[model samples]
Target: MRRQGIAPLPFAQGLALLDAVLARPAGNFVPARLDLREAQHAADAGEEVPALFRALVRRNTRPARARTSVTSAPTGLRDRLLAAPAEERIELVTQLVLREVAAVLGLDSADSLAPDQVLKHLGLDSLMAVELRRGLSAATELSLPATLAFDYPTPEEIAKLILTRLDLPTTPEATPASAASDAPGDATDSEALLGWALERLSADQLRRSGLLDRLVELARESAPAPEGTATVPAPAEPAGTLDDERSVDDINAELNALLEASGFDLD
Candidate 1:
């Protein structure tokens, strides 16, 4: 199965191997000899077969193992798994578990993992599942149930369990990209509603539409004035504004200007 867009089996490499075999001279055809050569040649051929095997390994290896240097999280994330606040800790733990799972399978990133995505669906077999359970158990410093990962089937479910076991709030954090049902209990909050609206506007779409800069401007405009200062309402028509008052042409012009400033050539 494919996980995080990575195919576990090297079908291409296998096909290449077959192609190389077929492309070789026809007289090399003895399977028994080939088997014997594979079995006996390691000791007899010494450097010859070993060199070929090493070359194959090098050629077939994934890019994940090609790294000579490793960069760690800026916040010492792996170490502070249990030390961060409830919401933060949950996100970190979920991220960590997902990363570890991805690592075991030689996957690139856990961002490919969704909160509701099942472990098994991501090319996880029984052994991988057990390994994930064990790793998460050690990471969280908890004697987690053996079937924890398999049973929950999803990161969010497992994360909520982790939070509950740790006596932390299991309530989900509200973010623009996350589901609107993040906090079922606080569904009516106006801020959450606004966040939900923002979430509906994807970053790329917002940027391409020039709504992101406008949204930022609107936020700056709506910010509360400092206390104890005489409240003076700003002029209704302010310069460099991107509010609803701006027409499509004006917004498009502003977008073009911003794009040009950012070295984005649309022409």
Candidate 2:
């Protein structure tokens, strides 16, 4: 585009430019597809695109910084795991591992995985293994090896490793479930058995397990307001007055104020 005399947009400004254009009703009519060469010409010479670029430039001078770390999981997960009783700790870790594995495999439910099925048999490759390890590391705040799936082979085995790495208490007597025969069938069957076991647990144990927090999150996700029913459109910007229109130099004085109003933060 620069070779064609088009100004290169800084990443943040480019995003702001997109938002500014999309705010207009005419923006919805923008073409869904365009020849690459023609798109470059349109960006370079189009009146609307240039005007929006000016507005975005007048809004911010600094570019946004890139993120420096992985997105973190919900706070206090490790602490919660530590506080839970031995049996419930095992259950929580098992559930967490199952969910992560299902997500990697694009399965609809975590229970779709069997506790004893080898990960390779379930189609987990090296890259998927690394992705799963990254997710588990973030969620559990533990340093998991890159070859996690190959070593553990199953969700149940991975869960046990995570618990061991976290140094979570699991005395054999305290965790009778560890000694019991593996539940017959898939993770769903095991979950059903777990449900029966939970009925015998105290409310305090359930709370410390973080099961209630998980349930609340699931409930909130499942009960979203109907789409379009609660949709709210952005209010239209008022016409600029003589004072509102300013030269480039004067605009810099109002840059932060304008970007704040438009919901962009360059810093």
Candidate 3:
């Protein structure tokens, strides 16, 4: 096509494209045949297609086919969320947020979004945050906050809030062993332990406790600086580029990166 070529076929692509059409079992193919009754009916109706065209159509016509049942599309998130047991909504929302937010942020994968990472730190500005909120709202069929992404800032926070909104327990039940009492300065230790614990919460474990939100809270809290060290603020996000300044392929590549990271399962 680029060379204005009328090239060879039976060619590779032509063969590949019609592999199903070509490789069809010989017996399955209905031999084209003329229908005398259909030709008589067309003549009676004074059909507009020329006689030669009509002959060609009749000669290539196959027998009437039985209507086959079509495959249905997969169930959507909203329906899945609604049909899930009352106890399972929190994890549902958590997965939903992680999947959609990662896509909007153009992240490489859903797993790369650590529970403690802030949206802004992951390149989510006001515009992308809004886009995420809208996407989550549409997916879950819930009216979420305009600043939902920034407000929660992490899947753990958003998941906890989802449970709270659904009237489920804000936190999972704690065991006496895991909740061992600690001193005030133990938070630093807890921070590290918490970081390690948060990473292991599989899709099933998210609803079992409030650990996700606690991780987010611990992460969101600011710790004091050492006496001699200075803390530097994060760099600002870049402004949007004009259409001409951006490459369409680059944008698509970024989108594909997110989907590929999602196991290419975002539909």
> Compared with the true structure, what per-residue lDDT tens digits does model 1 show for residues 84-115?
54557777767776777787666788767787
Best by TM-score: 2
Off by over 4 Å in 1: 1-83, 168-267
Per-residue CA lDDT of model 2 for 1-267, tens digit only, reads: 222234456788767767878888773543222223433444444323444234333222345466676655434667677667667887788888889898888789987777778999988988778879978998988899878899889988999998888886553564556544554445567556654554455434444575534544444454443543232222233577453243444433333233233333335
Query: Which candidate, 1 or 3, has the higher lDDT?
Result: 1
lDDT of 1 at 204: 54
Candidate order by lDDT, decreasing, is 2, 1, 3
User: For every model in order, what is the number of clashing pairs?
Assistant: 1, 0, 2
What clash pairs does model 3 have? 172-209, 172-210
- Residue 112 local lDDT, model 3: 74
lDDT of each: 0.58, 0.62, 0.56
lDDT of 1: 0.58
**lDDT tens digits, residues 131-218, model 3?**
7876777775678888788779888798777656655333335455555443234556754564355344342243235443343344
